[model samples]
Target: MVSTVEVPEADAQFWRDWGDPLLVSIVDATLRANHDIRIALSRYEQSRALTHQAGLDRYPTLDVSGDVSDRRVSASQAFGLSRAHRDGELHTANLSVIWELDFFGRVRRSVESQRADTEAHAADLAGVQVAVVAEVTDAYFRLLGLQRRLQVARDNESNQADTLRLITALFQEGRGTSFDTERVRTQLAFTRSRIPPLEAEAAVTANRIAVLTGREPAAVVTMLDRSAALPVYPAQINAGVPSELLRRRPDIAAAERRLAAATARIGVATADLFPRFTLGGLVGTQALGFNTLFQRDSETRVVSLGVGGSFLDVGRVRSRIAAANSAAAESLAAYEQTVLIAMEETEDALVRLSHAQAEKAILEQAAEASRSAALTARQQFEGGMVGVLEVLDVERSRLDVENLLAQSATQQATALVAVYKTLAGGWPQLIPEPQGDAMAQR
Candidate 1:
């Protein structure tokens, strides 16, 4: 039995030190350039402004007014009075204030709702930042994997070319059959044909990375040409529990905040069923001439208080409250669903990483055996120990094994990336300024 040894856990600080350089740079660049993050931040700022406006509803609004006018009066002869006309200017100003008492908590509820919305937007921004980091890191690793595969293909092509040359020399010397030479040449051509498509795929991956980093595709490719090393997974990760996921994930937090906002909206709607109260006062002066507008005796003042309520809108108010309740229920459901999805993702990533690691070992052994078989068959052909067909068959088997190994390596890398993504939580750690400077040099 082949003794199976578990791979040692990678040092967390080693992964952090190396992985941090590229990923942190990409994340920092993304945070500055990612359109989604910028948009969310802007929305959060707008929500903050709305919250401030909502709070203002609980305070009195004051207005001052002044006016100048000319008046003409005509007297009729009904009482035998003479008609007279006069022109005058009147100046008036008022400082009027209206304050909603909020006795029923209407303004308070509205303010609460706006504040919740602001919080939700802030959480949304954090979620976007996390997603951007994961995306950029995944793309970078994929590109590196492709580069490795491309190298493998080139190596295989060179080996096949050399084998074809040997077979041709044997045929010319009457030591090998024409069929053997033709078969080797055909395999070499097929191996070379795969290079173009792999190159094209690498280019596309580079373009995706550039767009994520908020740069032109061409510029990204230039940087990628110089960039090296794939992101390494940390040695240890704590997924916490399913319940902890709800608190850690930013999307879940945002959804809960939305629910709170919806609940507050219900209060706002219910408050409308009660009367609204306002207290207003005005101080103004009216004068026949602008020069005397500030005269103490010419000044006029009025203090007023008013209460207004819509008595005929009971049905409408009830409907609005019902709508708000339904909205609150919807938000709660959304929050629950987000939590469930996060748990699912964490579990799936864990399973995939475990399985991929196991599979890699099996594939590695298969590749080694296939290579040995191909070398033995080649020697047999040279020594007349086997037919040319046997040599062709063994070579093809070796190629297939090699390709499979490459694919398995990619799968393992992808699974590792998934594990990291699940454990990253909702916010990418902020890269310190000095670290960012070092990454730039790299």
Candidate 2:
């Protein structure tokens, strides 16, 4: 039960209410294979790796280095040969470690920023899934509407063609004017013109749906070849409160996460004002000959404490802090704006949904009346009680109303998709296992 005090939770699988198994499958497949989803997922993975990299600063780093050299002294330079061997091999090896001592918490702040960024990317991935599902569903409904309208246009054109033929016969029989024939011819041609564009759009929409589902356009067309009517809702769905709509939308979540990352960055920049410290050590062995390598007398050890600060470069540090603050401010504004936009979209969708049924009913009644009038006018024309002009007028009216009705139906379906997208509370995670062979090919 939705209420004023508490916003009802939107169904995560709200689109399923259309009761279309095909739609469910298409949405699921799109979530699984859509290119945008894959890209977002990859980005999320990159952020996670970056976060891990940032965290690595908290631990010691180890490095191993070694070098060997051979020396030969010329006669002219033999003054060194008396003190050192003419031919010699020298070997050195060392293992070194360095660890940042984050007394000012710079490393911690950096890691915090990266972690928040990772979360933002995760939300971005979810947002992409929401958008892809909505887009596919919208295209599917539009395709069905276009197909219906195409059929209506063709059917109307045939009827008008028959009318033109009748008018031509009447004119030949001295019972109709040339204007009557021309008028009927014009209407027939106009109706025929609507066909090509509708067919083109329908084809494009089908291809869009196929692309969303990660399939070839031809395959999608084949799968959708079977005729389908628009799904009808028996009753209106409730539009929950604005607060809940904002809370659940993935875009809002993403924006909020980014804001958090920006805030963390401010801390990171502020930490730059303090001194940096590190703990470093070296443990190794150096020998004049291979035989002395690793001997107790050849062992070496080193320990160091390093401190670095930028008291003279305070301007640069201050500038960086200012930039981070600005970024956080921008993020906060963006988050707020996103909330407003989400609310606006949800309101628009709800408004359309509210008026959808009434508008549909009105057009349906008008279509019925125009259809009846056209039939009556045709009968009167055949019975010699009416002229071709009246019959043509009625046919035009009938076609206009029906075409409008088809468009209205499509709007209703698309509006519902908008509502679900705008109010996207949550959705099931549907990432499938990566197909290794397919991925390798890509």
Candidate 3:
């Protein structure tokens, strides 16, 4: 019954609801044009080409060649050659065909392995896409969080400046001591000092976003200069049952596909234990003169059936088969490990996200309380009911709480991104799988 519950609006399309257009655009660009994604795509293409080659293993091969030659043979060497080779101006043309009959399924198994490898690479590309999206989203959230912190620092600086002015005025009128004025000045300077480091952090994050989107740092800096607020966290998230992870997680899928490839390779190697049968044919004509090369009497035709095996090296073949089996075992273990890791990652993200939300709620209340206390202290200081030191202390507490609140927001965003990545969310489902199509045709 709980599983059937309707998902919240923000949970269904998390990015669309929580992410601004710029964030979405940056993530899209990163997935589409990032160098890492491009490299994965290139690797997928390489695997696809290998799959095509493997599929050709069962097909016959044919070739045609024509040659014209002039040669003079010595009298002593003529005894070891045919009359045609002993003369000059020999002309020959031939067509040859060679076909390996896959009676033992060697070629078929090879094709299967290659196809599985290709699918694994395709999954790898999807994983890269997922990672790039997560990274860009996480980085953008960090940038927003930093900006919020910077704003808080600047606000505090302004508040402290006002406090310092009041202290200066009180001192000028002999109502405040030089020590109080100097202490307020020190607090104001400290507040002002926070701005530069915050600005630097924000700038670095912006540059990271720019590189993620395959753009120049200056361009990203210009684009991100526009003011934006951190997104509100969604109250309800529907993370479907863990079983869905097998299908949704690209890394797991990749590992599983690799295991399939490795298993298929065992068959490929085992096939080597049996005899290999090959059928070859040659049709040709030869004559001393080019015009007579195609003449009826000059025609020649030959056909042959070849059978070969590693009968003399049975130990070598068995060793190869054993190695393939061991590799398949390793791949199986890896697949299992990947599945466990995927589940662990998703669970970890969920736990962390929950904790971050709980922490943020408490911090939000603390910030509100601190804000009220700061306001009250400032009022009391102006009314001569409290010291400036009390006001500064409250203000400092408020600043720290606000900064923690911003960091909490960033942590939540990071955890959410991790969840999405582990789930392989936003994978390009519509992307063409060329190897699948080829396998279907086969």
Between prediction 1 and prediction 3, the one with superior TM-score is 3
- Model 3 lDDT per residue over 1-442, tens place: 0011111111224466554788777776786678888888889888887888777777899999989999888868778887767778888889999999999888888888888888888888888877877888888888887888887888899988988998999999999999999988998899889899989888998999888888889977988876577666555456677777787777887899899999999998888889999999999999989888887899888899999877457899899999999999999999999988988987888788789877877887788889899999999888999998888889989989988887887787787687677767732222222322110121
Clashing pairs in 3: none
Summarize candidate 1's per-residue lDDT along 169-253 as a digit string, tens digits.
8889998888778888888888888889978998998899889988899876877764353443333345666666666677887
Lowest-sum lDDT 10-residue window in model 1? 1-10
Clash tally, candidates in order = 3, 0, 0
* lDDT agreement of model 3 with the native: 0.79
Candidate 3: Cα lDDT at 203:
92
Which regions of candidate 3 deviate over 4 angstroms? 1-14, 76-86, 426-442
lDDT tens per residue, model 2, 80-119: 4563567777788999999999888888888888887888
RMSD of each: 9.2, 8.9, 9.7
What TM-score goes with each of the models?
Answer: 0.85, 0.85, 0.90
Candidate 3 TM-score, C-alpha based: 0.90
